[model samples]
Target: MAATGGSGRSTVADLLAAGMAADGASAVVLDTAPRLTSPWPSWTVGQEAEGLAALPPDRPLTRSHVRHAAALRPGADRPDWHVLTDGRDWHSPPLTLPQAPAAWLQLAAIGGWQCVVADTPHPVTHDLLQSRCAGHIGLTRSWCELPYAVPVLCASATAGGVQALQQAVMALHAEGMPLQRTVAVLVAQTDGRLPAVARAGATMLSARIAAVVHIPHDPHIRAHGLRTVTRLRSRTRHAAGLLFHEVLAAAGASWGTPLPDAPRPAPLAVVSHS
Candidate 1:
């Protein structure tokens, strides 16, 4: 979850999912943003594919539905990560997006993918302020509480962003969220020196979380959207790699010893082969 808008939430999500897939981990990205604004589920299996709206939670989720709703086109070589998001066009009137609980219900049906990288809406801290406490914990809480979930909290490496993140961390701690297993990321806006607030924020917040990672500014990402993983600079990639390692370590801490891979039925090839 992110504390503010433009906090590199999607950038982190893409990096984690793509990195996992490149390492042969079964991973998928769930984009919890609207089609008009989201950068995921760029395309689907067919022109008529309706993304998550087509894969309703009323029926059990299957590997076929998972792939069909994903961004992949038919017969395309499976890329490192697959995206699931609202695929509807701009002309269409907006439909009510699924809440985190409903999205989690749909997630429970899928059998294969080992990791789900969720790129959620912005200003989660703001939302909590307006929402009911107990009922609104939603995916932010559900996914974190999982046996092997690794929560990565994001905020822009700015003074306001740091303050927002601190508020969120304190609120989550109050709500019994797993701060120990959480990884905090500060997305830097420039290659120049980080603000005193950013540095001090990291120092102040270090004791409350697993570890903090800072992503250096990448000109490529600023010019173009986060599409090609190779475009990331060496330093940026290094940060991503470190972030991935922290995520793995945190997830490992959740389950202690690694769990054996669950057996799969023949029909579901690698959790619905692309």
Candidate 2:
């Protein structure tokens, strides 16, 4: 989509800012709903773009719209927003991926932080992440996959933003500390700047990552202001939010319901005991 669209689909940069603001992005879960889905049943990219464009400019960009949009007119047009595919995973408030370098990561853990990985496979991103950690701890050569326990952030499918994305990936790596569980968040913010390093990095790490998230510099961009694109940004945010919720749910679903441990006998036959 054009950075400044006449049809008003809103560029990636606009969407990122608006979505972040409307949702009140916070350290934890941002209170916003960005649509999140998979490409199941295989809907054409053109069809998906139209569905996203169809949303009204003033729409609240809530969870309901996400559901409604998924159930579009053409039955086959329904978006695969729920299923968790191996593709890029998106989230609000962002998350990092692939445990940060061992040493830095340990420091972060002491500070109560953990690393979350976005499914970015950009060579630069990979190099950056790997540099921090050094030696494949668990990273794979497969399709944009990250180590287990890491979260993924999804961005627009457009290829133009690849450069900026590379920068984001590198930034995360640069900021990451070893031994700490870092959260690697990825998103496709179309208009944001991709540092020189990022561009170079992409050449080194292409098709290895799912996407990159170029964090907005100004909150006003994300807020409901003159520069914001309401509908598009909202939709993007909804998708991200849904992904976040899904990740949390999956983690919770793993272990079976907690069975009450047999009441521990008072210290196993405590003798005389004062």
Candidate 3:
């Protein structure tokens, strides 16, 4: 997942990981952001940091090294998923651009993980963007960042935000990014009913993008740190499920069959022009 900055890309990555795990897919999140915040803090102990410290700077990372760096959180409703982070506060020995692809390959080789979500920094440098991942999810709080072609999830929380999303879609088309790979996610950041402009923006976005999902603001998600979707409110979980499904589809992933215990969100009503 790539975000310009503070667009809650980490949160989206976490939700996607949880959703995949719930669906019986072994998932792992790779934190490539400069600021080493663990998306799965609920499971990571200090040992994760120690594992990072032990990594050799000179050699290519191996599956064993990745396992060593992997942190697990137990006792969730689903099987435990792993998170691989740099495990340090500062980006001292950062993963160089050349090393990123190798690191991703090593993680893929770790075996049994069906999905790997990466939370990356702004502009998503060319090297990382070209890596062999399923697809990309670009998050932006503002519409100004929507010109690229990769699939995107925009968070519209206000009237201006809505307008920005509409304009961004036009800019995206002008830039040659297919609207079929784009998505606009309506995030109700406030408690009151959604603004009319936001609703209209969602309608317009639905006409252009593959899907549009509305995620009502949930205090539980905001206050609670790093928890499963099961712990979220019904509406929040439902919206997350819809977004997850669309994301996987855009990535060309075979969702296979849903697990019996998996929480599946109802599909959002979309207004498509096509």
The TM-score leader among the candidates is 1
Model 2 lDDT tens row, 119-177:
22234344445745765533222212222332332333235344444454454445442
Q: Which sections of candidate 3 miss by over 4 Å?
A: 1-4, 36-58, 73-75, 89-106, 109-112, 123-150, 227-231, 252-274
lDDT of 3 at 149: 18
The runs of at least 3 residues in candidate 2 whose Cα sits more than 4 Å from the true structure, single-residue gaps closed, are: 1-100, 113-148, 153-155, 159-233, 253-274
Instruction: Please write out the lDDT profile of model 1 over residues 117-165, one tens digit for every residue.
Output: 7777856566555454556555566666554667788989998889988
Please give the CA lDDT of all the candidate structures: 0.71, 0.31, 0.55
lDDT for position 14 in model 3? 67
Better of 1 and 2 by TM-score: 1
Model 1 spans > 4 angstroms off: 41-50, 72-79, 108-111, 130-139, 259-274
What is the lDDT for 86 in model 2? 19
lDDT of 3 by residue, 119-165 (tens): 55543323223332425432321222321212555554677666655
Model 3, backbone clash pairs (residues 3+ apart or across chains), number: 0
Per-prediction count of colliding residue pairs? Answer: 0, 59, 0
How far is each candidate from the true structure, as Cα RMSD in Å?
Answer: 5.6, 17.8, 12.0
